[model samples]
Target: MNIIKVRITVSLIFEKIFGKLLKGHERSIQAKKNIALSFLFKGLSITINIILVPITISYINSNRYGVWLILSSIISWMNLFDVGLGNGLRNKLSQTHAFKQYSRSKVYISSTYAVLLIVSIGIYLLFFLVNQFVNWYAILNVSQASIYNLNEVILLFVGFFCLQFILQVINVVLTAVHATSKVSLISVISQITALIAIYILTLFTKDSLILLVVALSGIPLLVQLIATFWYFSKQYKHLAPSFQLISFSQAKGLLSVGGYFFLLQIGSLVLFETDNIVITQLFGPNEVTSFNIAYKLFSVLVNVFTIVITPFWSAFTDAYTLNDFQWIEKIFKKMYLYWIFTIAVAVILVMISPLLYRLWLGNLAINIPILLSIAMVLYVAGFCWLMIHCYLLNGIGKIRLQLMLYIISTLINIPLAIYLGKIWGTAGVTLSNVFVFLYMDILLFIQCKKILNRNATGIWNM
Candidate 1:
């Protein structure tokens, strides 16, 4: 009888705590499930990248591997072409869903897809017109012999990237609807397909970066195209993007929000993604590989934190639109504990990273300074901290301050990175971000407090 009573008491307490934590929102509970699924799938996908890195380097000389990384980085620039529609769609959908406005959500979907299709086509045409004028070899710092190879691969990659970008609206829709688990499922399948294709290409093809990129870019396209087809055909057919369904009013609404998002993406790309280019310019292509390897190891924390926070983006939108300050306050308060936990995780990752790097890279591992490792840890730590609040800001559509901070950061990043890179080399490149991004967390934290207190004005409004 004593043991039975103890079990019953424990179960009751667990249920009480969980129910309180969930705050009576079915979306909150569902978001947790989605977060778990995303973590699992992204973990698997990241593993593929980790495994591929060393294999790719060993198979294709470090210089060529660096070129591929740099070129692929450039291709990623094309993603901003959507100009924030993806995230705007997410916020719009979540807000509509919060009020049970399903029809409005469908209109947003149609308008976003229509706009994205036009943007993707414009990008391809624009690239084709300009591709001949740009010296690919000079840009990548590669030999002239590889220029033809680079040209062939870049066109293929960019074409597929545009197609994939348009198709990715399906995912934006899924993410907005808080169907992120399905999004993860699609990502896992796509990564696995890419991995298999890459493996086969390594065995059958020469060390041509073009062939390698084809495998990298093409397989994911097939997967995304198929997922888009299935979702439109069945699951989200009611909201399926049709030419007739596009609305000028809805398009204006999405672009209104999306334009800010576009500028912010450019700011982020300049601040964070340009490091590889900076390193390549200052150090060498070979050093790019070394720097990015350490980055991948430390970036695990950012990726993990991202998986945790992604669900909250749209969830925050739903609660904020509904004016659930109590729930918002409760959730943000809980995230302080998460932020502490992530800082601790960053410390632990830094501590064991040397061994982890050796095990993962074996002979391929270059000697990155312990200091650089620590800096990378701090970089992601600050990044994760900023993201916790940034997502909330994005969700609530209070992005003016966030955008302003990013613009300043972007203007300063290139010069800061170069000046620092000259003095401290690799550590300085990442350290620039650490120093610049501190403003984001500090300012955003204050903004969150002001908004919660319902006294938001001045800089908060600006």
Candidate 2:
């Protein structure tokens, strides 16, 4: 009788604390679970990255490390060539799953894979044809003497890049299924494996960029490949992308939705990815390292915020499809509270960054100015805010306004980044990025509110 009373009391307390937040709706329950799991996996992934960086720097020197960073950024542009099909597949697949359209889902999956495979092949053959003609050393603003096997190294990077490009669609498929935590787990595994590979290389090999590229790029691709096979053969086998299911008609529907996403991806590449190249060109590869170290430090806040919001894209899609506005409104209110909490953490992170830099980079910590850290904090704050709004709009397939906004922002970023980079160095480039994020934040916040309240009209509706 005493034990029964105690159990009843504990259950009542749990209900009182989390009844609405955790137990009210199926969507809420799934989002909460994914967010919790993402925090666990992403925390481990970030820790591995932190440990991986210093070791990599010690192994290859900061300049070469910076070169690797810039090259990786440049190659990352290849992801855009999917023409939004990945995101198209994500949103479309999510909708199909919600409606239990299993056969259509398979067609969507197969068609996306077929299209991306064709794209990857074209990209690889194009690179093979042109690899010898371009002077990579001049393009990257690195000296030939500082690097060797340059063409071969780029070829290897591109090869791995194209293959990974096709395989990583599995991540999008997982996200669409509201299994975002699984995506985070894959990332954690890949990063951990890369860290281990780098450690082994340090012990047995000379500091060769080619070998570093192989270890860093190869491991992740291998993991994703295994995941693709395992998933297709098991849990998601029914929705597997088979050759016979390739449907250009389904592909057309996906492209219709994804065209805006493709453009947005391009604009994002310019806004975010070009900073390293700008830093390397205006300053040097060494400055790129200092800038990146600071970025990696402050990006902790952005990464954490992403974990909170990542699962919500598909959640929002489901709610919108079902006309569940009240749930969307309530969740946005909670998200606002979380956003405020993130801003507080960002300020705290900046306050202690000097000590962090010292511990994180040891003697390599001398160059990161307090100003750069401050700039990064502002950049992170704005980026996180923009993400909260953008995810909702994307989830609902109302992205025309976002597409237009990105075009305007992209046009402004490159020149502004160059101009500011000349005066403020790397911090200027970051501030330029902050400006773009701030612009999007104000407009997107207004748009999200209008749409949620059913007051959206004209461009705001889109």
Candidate 3:
């Protein structure tokens, strides 16, 4: 058939262009497949997210939407309470799966789940006790008149997030096994469900932030819960978490690595998540909305870059385990080329961003300054550049340098963000992030190069 001939012609062009680099390598082949499928799912997820933003803004005013963004950022801090177990489990499970050690992977899985479950319960209890005195309305810089149910909304979101925290471990588990496509599929389903729920709310119910929170937070949790049960019962049944496999001794190994990751998580939260809090405190919620709108627009490139490289975290683990340094070198070259492409795309997106905002948000797009879009382009470039080295280091388990850099970044970002926000408004906060990410990117790139060249020593090797 003509279709078959076209397929063959396209295959020939791909082979001719990339040549033997990906021809015989099973890791590269599998990674290509993951990238292909992830693009499909993530494309849908991105579209839904873009559509959700305008729809959400329509349902609630910009100030309330800004409050929601701030609250979500604050609640997301609790993900650190997992103490890096999720990522630790990711690296550990990837290594185990590489060696065909299913039993060992199961023990790691169960141990991580047991620890997260206990941590989630304790977090819920601790927050319940702490929530009474926190004065969240004041912290959010919103009036009680605007959101009387702020406390109840916080309580409801925390409850859903606590449960979702445990159930979402399935994502890490799937990624470890090179099943990131499934993880993307799960996210798409959750996003679709949330969109439908919100659409229904718009049809029947009055605009209530509480109901918005329920639809946004609760639906994802429900979907993840179903997926956790379904995946464990079928494809991953052999590695399901159970009381029998939960081992305190086994947990120490995960914590040993995860502990460092835990500290890094806190540092990351400070570096990335505090922008909204700072904007809300200093510039009010309206500017926060503008900052996020710009951020969301530019984040498309970051997400695409992530989809391409996500599979390589585990692939790097496999290669390093086998001492296949040449393969690592080849992949790094390919990644750099991709990074160059992202930079080009970021430039183009920045050029057309005003038109994009008009199309995406209509009148609501007026407040987002072009300066914010420019800074966001810089942020995305730094982020994509940093992720390349960071993932390889994490996969190869050389993160002491990354940990130190994040600590320094954490210390530097907040004051800089505040100082810059005062000077440049919301754009200043974003530029502050750009400065930190560029600093980290340079150092981590050095560490990655040294390790890959087999010349790293002392802290770099660590």
Error of 2 at 111 (Å): 0.6
lDDT, candidate 3, 1-462, per-residue tens: 999999999999989756743566888888887788899999999999999998898898899999999998998899999989998999999899989999999999999888888999999999899888889988989999999888889989999989988998999999999988899999999999999999998899876999999899998788999999999999999888888899988998999979988988998899889999999999889888888888988898899999999999999998999999999999999999999999999999989998898899987744788888899989998989989998998888898999999989988999999999999999999999999998899989999989988999999999
Candidate 1's C-alpha runs over 4 A off are 1-24, 146-148
Q: Model 2 segments beyond 4 Å from truth?
A: 1-22
TM-score preference between candidates 1 and 2, better one? 2
TM-score of 1: 0.93
Ranking by TM-score: 3, 2, 1
**Which pairs, if any, clash in model 1?**
none
lDDT of 2 by residue, 1-462 (tens): 999999999999989766754787899899988888899999999899899889999888889999999999999898899899988899998899999998999999999988888999999999999999999998788999889788999999999999998999899999999999999999999998899999999999978999999899988888999999998899988888889999888898999889999999999899889999888889989999999999998888889899999999999999999999999999999899999998888889889998988898876544888989999989988898899999999999999999998999889998999999999888899999998888789999999999999999999998
Q: Candidate 1 residues 1-462, lDDT tens each?
A: 999999999999999867765655686787877876788888987898888887778767788888877877888787898878888788888888777787778788888888888888999999988887788877777777644566667887889888888888888888888888788788878878877877887788767777777677778888888998898789887667767778978888887888899898998898778988998999878878888888988787788888888888888898877788887888788788887898888899889988988899888746777878889988987888888888888888899999999999988999999999999998999899989988888999899889989999987954
Task: For candidate 1, give the lDDT of residue 65.
Answer: 81
Model 2 TM-score on a 0 to 1 scale: 0.96
| Least well predicted 10-residue stretch by lDDT in candidate 1 | 144-153
Per-candidate clashes come to 0, 0, 0
TM-score per model over all chains:
0.93, 0.96, 0.96
